[model samples]
Target: MNTRSFSFRLLAWYTCLLTCIFVLLCALLYLDLSRFLEHNVEQSQVRRAHQITDTFLATIGKTGPSYVAGQAKALYEPEISDRFVRITQANGPIIYASGMPKDGSFDPAEVPAFPPVSSRESFHRVKLSNGKTLVIAALNYHGPGKTSYVVESGALLDPAELNHLVLQLLIGLPVAVVIITVGGYILVRRALTPVERITRAAEQITQHNLSERLPVSRTGDELERLSISLNRMIARLDDAFQNSKRFVADASHELRTPLTILRGELETLIENARLDPEVRERATSMFEETVRLTRIVEQLFTLSRLDAGEAQAEWSRFDLAGLAKTTAEQMSLLAEDKNITIACDAGQAVVVEGDAARLKQVVVNLLDNAIKYTQSGGAVQLHVRRANGHAILEVEDNGVGIPSEALPHVFERFYRVDQIRSGEFEGAGLGLSIAKSICSAHGAEIEATSVPRKGSCFRVTLPLSKN
Candidate 1:
């Protein structure tokens, strides 16, 4: 469960995007509700003002100012109470007031001065210290004796509808988000299920199992298309690997018998008393080359079997230290020609279960490489020890060490470093690759480390035997 995995990261992105969208939608809803409430409240107040002004003007000249006021109050007082109402003289004296402070007064400055409304009253919202919201309107009103007055109407904001909108937002937003997020994760997981299956199948494949193909999906979507492509690639790789194994086996079998006969004939010819000295020397050189070719062919055959999983390890519990010492003693004779020192540290008996002959090949190859690369007067050391229940076999050389770039590919088949490829060194470059294959077949690991002009070290780790 990695929190930083692709699935979790995608979910995080979805959540952030959804949250922003949710907030925007919620804000838009709130604004629309506020606007609807304010407009409805203002329009209701304006209509009430029209009724009060018309009734007052109609009765004003037929009766007295006091009479008109009392009649206007009687007819429109109920309507005026729900919303606050006020009437004022042109000089700004309050003539009538209701649903406001009992003093029957409002601040004249609070009234917005707009051109007298011929058809509609101009409205504005005012906030009072008491935490009440009111929509106030000012309209022109004609009174008795050519006197004019301003009729101002106030309406309380409709809170019931706005509160409903608030409740909907508070309750619905979280529920919607939860539902959408859960659904998004499920959808994403379903979408990635093929990838997970592909990964699991790929993990099960190895060199021995290259023939296995990934399960191809038929959904015809991108994932399905990817699966088909990978299956085709794996099929091609399996074919190539099989062809390589077959070629090695076939070539090795074909060349070894002829080379054996050639060697025998050369040996016979060189031994003849009648042979010319110069011709004998040439035959000797040819014999040496034939021997090298035979060795390379045999190595290639062994590797082919290893790759095809036909080479079975003959496990035995043997003294690994003894094996190391014996291999070093044999390699020392080769080292002597270059005047290099070969030191062995195998005083302890570290026993391990493996094919002794194959393990011997591993040691021989490492020592061979060390001796070949080390300069005259250089040193090669072989140490066999048990560490953490495993046998550690180390071969170190003080020679022209591998360059940093060449170290990694030293064990790869036929991979010669640039210097070696320049004809300064003699090898087909199959020795380390063969050694690595042998180690792997025995369930062991071989690793190399080096520095330019410093030296190279090879370590082989094998599991210690219980016997």
Candidate 2:
């Protein structure tokens, strides 16, 4: 705490700026007070000195030379104390002194030393023989021709008052500084509390606890928004971790089938005499499984590319309708084995920009999925058309369709609609996942519609080229 925090820095800057302003104000105040006090002393003392001279002139104006020093002293000394009073004839030598030095003498050589009087200013400094400084003032009682008395008088300020003023300034400034620093620090800390809380939350996060989320409060500030963002990132990471685990398990399990067949074929060949029909039959089954394994391996590679965003769709204007007709013709042979008919309801050639090979893959995967599940005499049909500024392709079948619960996950890598314990007869379950990825890369949307024991259909919509 003594070393200071972010809040303390903010407070220190704020207080420094305010303290400078306060010091400037205090300096101005002291200057104004000095001017005002000096003016009061000069004007009052000068007025009294002029009054004494005016009295002497008035007597000379009336009785003539009757007003003397003893009468003047009696008239003014009680009214004004310790004033250095002197009267000169305009610019001439000293004529009278009512409040001057005692022991009868007007010594011109022993004149008091003082700063020169500024007529423009009311106050001037004068030094007594004792070295005490007095702020003094002078005035001419009358104008030149009959000019009689130039009167002067002043008072010395007390040293104790000056000392008190200095002490108060020193003590007051430090107290003000402390108050400002403390109050400013408190306010800054309250304002930045949210930021500190966010820092603590980030520190607590670890790889083992990705499920943990940052705490968000009613303060819907920027820090709260940041917490929300962190929580979402953590959730996505958790999902990806789980997906990675499932991918490894499913890949290993799928490869076991082909590997088991190969091993069984080799075992038969090793344990029995060669050139036998039954042994040859086992070899043929193993060979088919090997071909299936190669296809699955290729699909896995495609999935890896799709996830990494390396599977780029080549944009080309082509006849989607013609492509559908050709793809249906190709899949018809596979359908024929199960007494299923493959038909194409090809609309007019709708030219679209998309990856030709990937779109062909989408059609082929749909056909494969449809024929694989369809019973004898069931039909698998391919439909291509243009609507809503898009080229829509659909594959529909009359077969044992997918359950609604499993349909959502059918496009996930290695996810099986019929779990492995039941439908090991079907190939690896990356077909629809490939179809989904291809559609995505082409900037198209794909969806599945299925009814349990009824039928399943997948539709893909691609944007039609405006040109």
Per-prediction backbone clash count: 0, 0
How many Å off is the CA of 427 in candidate 1?
1.4
- Across residues 143-245, which tens digit of lDDT does each residue of candidate 2 receive? 3358555566666644455567667888998999998888787888888877778778767876435677777876777777887887898899878875884
Instruction: Quote each prediction's TM-score.
Output: 0.75, 0.46
Give the Å error, residue 370, model 1.
2.1
lDDT of 1 by residue, 325-435 (tens): 998898888899999989999999999987888889889999988988888999999999999999999999988898888889999998888853437778888989988
lDDT of each: 0.81, 0.73
Off by over 4 Å in 2: 1-5, 53-57, 63-68, 78-80, 98-122, 127-132, 143-145, 204-467
TM-score of 2: 0.46
